[model samples]
Target chain A: MTGQSTGQSTRQSTWYSTWYSTWHSAWKEQPLSFKLSSIIVVLVLCFGVINPFISYDPVLDVELSRRDLAPSWEYWMGTDGQGRSVALRLFKGIEAFFFPGLIAGLFAAFVGGVLGALCGYFGGWIGRSLSAVLELIDTLPRMVFLVLICTIFPPSILLISIISSVLFIPSIATIIRRKVEALGAEDYILAHVAHGFHPLKIISYHILWLQCRALLTRQMIFVFSYVLFIETALSYLGDYGVQEPYPSWGNMVAQSRISAVAWPWALPALAIIITIAALLAFGDGIARREEEVKR
Target chain B: MSEQTLVDVQDLVIEFDTPKGRVRVVDGVSFSVSPGEVLGILGESGSGKTMSTQAILGLIGGYPGVMGGQINLNDQGVTYELLKDLPSFISERRGQPEKNERAWRKHRYAQMKKLWGRAITSIFQNPRRSLDPLMTVGQQVKESIQARESHKDALERLNDQAQTEEALEWLAKVQMVDPARVYHSYPHELSGGMCQRAMIAVALACKPSILVADEPTTGLDATVRAQIVHLLQDLIKAEQCAMLYITHDIREMLYLADRVIVMRHGKVLEQVSANDLKEHALERHEYTQVLLDAAGMIGAHDE
Candidate 1:
């Protein structure tokens, strides 16, 4: 009888967990538009990765005779001033431009989220100190600071990415800090403490889960947009991703601008604009889903 | 009269430090709870009943309260001199007072954490705020079980997993309907009586030797109030667990308490057995008469 009862409980627990997981999934499932955009982004990223190794030669084929050739099968995205295939070059630029921004944003979000959660939960002097530091960082012009850091350092893709991440951290931290502060005041946390749950357990299992879910989802969209903007800005400025062997949407547009009457810059420029637009659309969908789940 | 004293309080005083000045809440109160006995503490609002309990739980930190007294729990083999120069000093001598102050304080706190649900548990007045809104009723009970059973061996641990079943059983003990469905529901989903029943299940999860129920039925409806009282009476008799039922209701004191202690303005006005209270209603004391009159008022209100 005892064994049967135990088995029954086990089944009940399994059913409970499965039901909870399904409910949670329903709450968090990405919207159709966001999912579609995400698919496009992934496909684009994959194409960027595979292009150089497959059909396109992004470097080493100087078409001096055919410089600034406009749209044809031989040069699908036309050729830039250096005779590099604008399409293939743009694909190569993905590694230097987009990836760095992605990494920087993610790193910043992670650090900010964790720090904010700790500060909010613990409060008192620790929270105050973190807030002070975050405020000081927030006071600076982050984009200018990123430019200054890149200028001071021997600008590698890694250094630029790190600089971008540093720029992003304080704002994300402040957002997460506010979220944590709100969650800390919840009755569940007090209940956990009253029941003698350890401080670490209360912070980790109760407070972090409560605050991080919505903030992290919101941060993902922010990071995606911010990274794209930073990468494009860097490329436009000619501080990075400008040399002949390197291909970037910003540099291609820059090159196209110089010889606009001779060559059409629309295709590559359109691709850049389209990719950013798609990302923004995707982020909006995600934001909507997050809002719905929060409700 | 001492089979084993679970809690002993002598001249317990609690003062809160406000911006204006020091305000004494619980002044010179003395009481004791023995094993397997119910001690009903009856008091008016702001009479220091809640504050005194909070002091016992060591939750009144930095509230500007000076608690001066000795509280000894014989079952835990610990005595606490509540009011000392430092907060650390009081906590140090809490449970098992013989260990070095610093080490004993750490040990006592740790021990309290371990013993909370198993040896001593509490039921709050507001069941809504007392439970986690995010968690299912079952999970909260499971959490209490996990806390108390942290040190149990494997077979005993299996029994601990049976806590949910035990909790469900306790639901029936509390006269709750459809325990299984109620267990799966959230706090807000349940009615006030059901929520209180779930709280009782959580309190009894670890089979505590002493249960501190802080106004268990104050906010409940009249019908639900009687049911809750009856449920508590049944559980108390069945489990033989000592209970400290804190309430302002004098009738509830007479109905549920083996012995009752009445308080006014943080001072104990009267303490008497339920039988003595009924038999000597007019002659015992003026405070006793006041309590009886209060009970009569509640009876009239019920009518």
Candidate 2:
């Protein structure tokens, strides 16, 4: 009995070692852009999660006497026209950027993935009607619709996220549906059906989880960047988004319009550019890796 | 033909809608297979040899699928018609093939779900594409075997070591060189012959009474093709299962099949014994003679 137990332990160890080596090698083979973008994304996510709890000097504590103060030892960056610390407000804006996009991305991916799989797998009247509704959403003017929603409801991260998720679902669902339609014709699907596997299991696990994982990940990441852009754009328009004294990135940019020099706007603008670029690059990297695996 | 008939298909007619009009793919083709028997369906491309088997397997779908047919299976002594309710869901119309597609599909799925992979299983032509690419060979084979157990037991047996051992045994039974390595390997990693072997292992793991091999050796190389044919022959004899072997190669069919059914243009020309055809003792159709000639057997017999 002891000898048998020893043999089993050795077998398990060998299996673990082999799996670890393969995963390590795969990570090493990733492209430079993917690695860089991954590091930046992880850092941004860490800051987003941990930054809110750490209290700093208040950005809303206005001081008219210290308005337009230049960069000095007291302020790392500088004071804005409203006499608020630019760096503190930038730190607070991280939550606004990260949380809404995350919510919207998750909502869209889950809903769209299910809808697309159904439409693509069983294409009949159900597919036709669902596709018709999606197309109607697609034809509507996006900017005009967003503006209308913002005006009707008080603009907040939760409300904006929900609206963006609804808007993003049709596109994601359409993509998933097209992919399902193409893969449905393959022989593997027919073989699985003949094998007596449940159609729902095959569609969800085999088709979605195994086959279309990379495509779905890329789409989800792209949605994050889109939400970030929309939030900042609305905040910058002045009347809507986050409101005064809230220190959102968009309102911060609006505050910079008073000064002649571009330094006040530089920090927020750089934050938006860097975050969106990193997201796009990360998505592109995933797509490139998927192609390589296929080859 | 002393053993009981496992599956009996009679007067199966399949049609598809085209841009021009409706075209019949399998026009009233019929055959049956008994336990421990090999029935070869010999035909050229587009001869509907595959279509007839697909119809029996209930894998047909889309517009005008299996328009008129009777596919009956004596599943463990309980016989039932596979296409009994198809007519009720179909409606005849002028200049068009109108079908209540959703209802037909629902009915067909309900009828076939219990029998597929349990009573009947099939090995398709392209083995590489037929096997799921993401799953390991062992996992897929294990899934087939696990489907035999009760649902509650299957859930508890999800990580059971016995199924893994059983799957490895199946791999060895199919004559794989190294069962352990091949068990963990993905479908894309193996050669064509190895993939076909894995596919056969998966099909037989369920312990079904009937196996449908649709041109299993078509895309393989010459040596691999011969080896696969030999492996299939040995498995059929050992398992004592009924098989419907579909192929266009007259020579291989003659060597492997007990009886031959020659088909052309969606019709069966003749059904002859393989031994009689080999000795040129039985009367054969012109198409069968043409196939024999192409296989270079006629000249050899004459010489």
Candidate 3:
């Protein structure tokens, strides 16, 4: 009995090893940028989820006695000018911008996908008028427009995200519209039209779902990364973003200007750069795969 | 035979504004098809054989398309007038077709939507490309089936099993070797002939009154083309549906079409019965004679 149990365990171990090796080899075959971006995104999400439980109270509570402390066991990124844990604030900062970025990205994807599909599929006066309106919106100075809106309305994460998403809509819609137009001219699409399928059905099921899904996802990630950059820039400008005592990356970076130590500003700035770069790389990787599939 | 005309197209005119200026692709083309009849439009490339059918199907678009036409459909117990009030929507200025582009599109498209699929369906030239690559043959056939079938019961749709059974039946009717396998396979997995068969199955699944086949055999090999043509002939006969068979090949046209209309330079040259052509009973036009000579039918007839 003992010998039989040992033999069965050996067989199971071999099966497990074989499955793992196959999975590992498949992962290795992916593009370098895809792997890197995926890893960063996963790590960021993990940190974001565990942040509230792991981060100390230094994010909000001021401890003047521990001011400008160097990196230590208790303080991972060391303390800032106000004796707040920079590491804890950075984790909180991820939460601050991430949710809002997601909201804005989803908004752009849904609204822009529908509008673009309509404009591209029906290219008569509807296409003409829609293109005209989008082009008019495109001509506006985005930063200036954003700043004006921020000033007029009370600055909040949701409002900022929504405003930036509106500015990004025209561009996203333009890309999708071009894709739909090119696809609409294909013989298969015309055949679908001839087969008497409704225009909405064709656009959604065939055009958007089957053909343009990757492009839409890539565009969504692009909007997410863009929102992150905009948020960081606004926060860095002080007065307009999350105020002091709130643990946003921009406000933390704002606290670093007078501090003699460099870790506080450098750490958050680095986080900002790495997050945006990873998101962009992930989107571009998807785009490259899409093009390869097309070829 | 005094059968009711299923489709009557009269004085159809279609134009396009090219860089060179306005070109009338279909000029005063008139034809009609009765149930269980095959009306073949025989022409070489750029001869407007396809355009006239496109107009009848309401598939014509672009600037100034179908400028003047009257297509009347008598099918499914509904006598509908296609291209009604078309002239009211269009005006000619210095030979350029002009109108309120927005209103015309809105009105004409809404009018055309009612006739598509159930009243009139079409099989496009390239079969592989025409079938949605992403959808299985069964799914596409099921979709076309569901388009009109659900309307029969007035809200209660066919269950999945029933739809699948119907789709497989259609695949078998189109002469698919293995209906079950073909049902599960996507268009890309099938051969060119098989793809065309699937396309036929999709088009016929709705049981349309009229089927417009545009160069259905253009891309197939000799044997496959012959097989497809035979299959189409048998299916049309069995279903008793009117077909608008468009082809440049004279022999195929003569073999399949009951009545043949030979066209060139966007004008109809001759309209004669296929039996009359075979028997040399009528004095054909010079262009029709040229086509006959090209097809080597005259030599065969003399022998």
- Kindly report which residue stretches of model 2 are placed more than 4 angstroms away from their true locations once superposed: A1-27, A56-76, A82-84, A259-261, B1-3, B95-98, B150-159
Query: Which consecutive 10 residues in model 2 chain A have the weakest lDDT in total?
Result: A1-10
Best by DockQ: 2
Q: What's the number of clashes in each of the models?
A: 1, 0, 0
| Top of the candidates by lDDT | 2
**Tens-digit lDDT string for candidate 3 (B151-225):** 467567787667777777788788787777777676878999999999998998878889999999999998999
For candidate 1, the docking band is acceptable
Better of 1 and 2 by TM-score: 2
Where is model 1 chain A poorest over a 10-residue stretch in terms of lDDT? A1-10
**lDDT for each residue of candidate 3 in A72-153, tens digit (9 for 90 to 100):** 9999878889888777788887777777888899898888888888888787788889988988888998777877877898
Cα lDDT of model 2 by residue, A63-144, tens digit? 8777777788887678888788877788787777688888888888888899999889878889989989988888776666
lDDT tens readout by residue for model 2, B135-220: 77887887777765433354565454777777778888898887777777878899999999999999998777889999999799
TM-score of chain B of each: 0.85, 0.94, 0.95
Stretches > 4 Å off in candidate 3: A1-29, A45-58, A65-77, A121-127, A290-295, B1-3, B92-101, B176-190, B279-283
Report the candidate with higher TM-score, 2 versus 3: 2
Instruction: Tell me each candidate's i-RMS in Å.
Output: 4.8, 5.6, 14.8
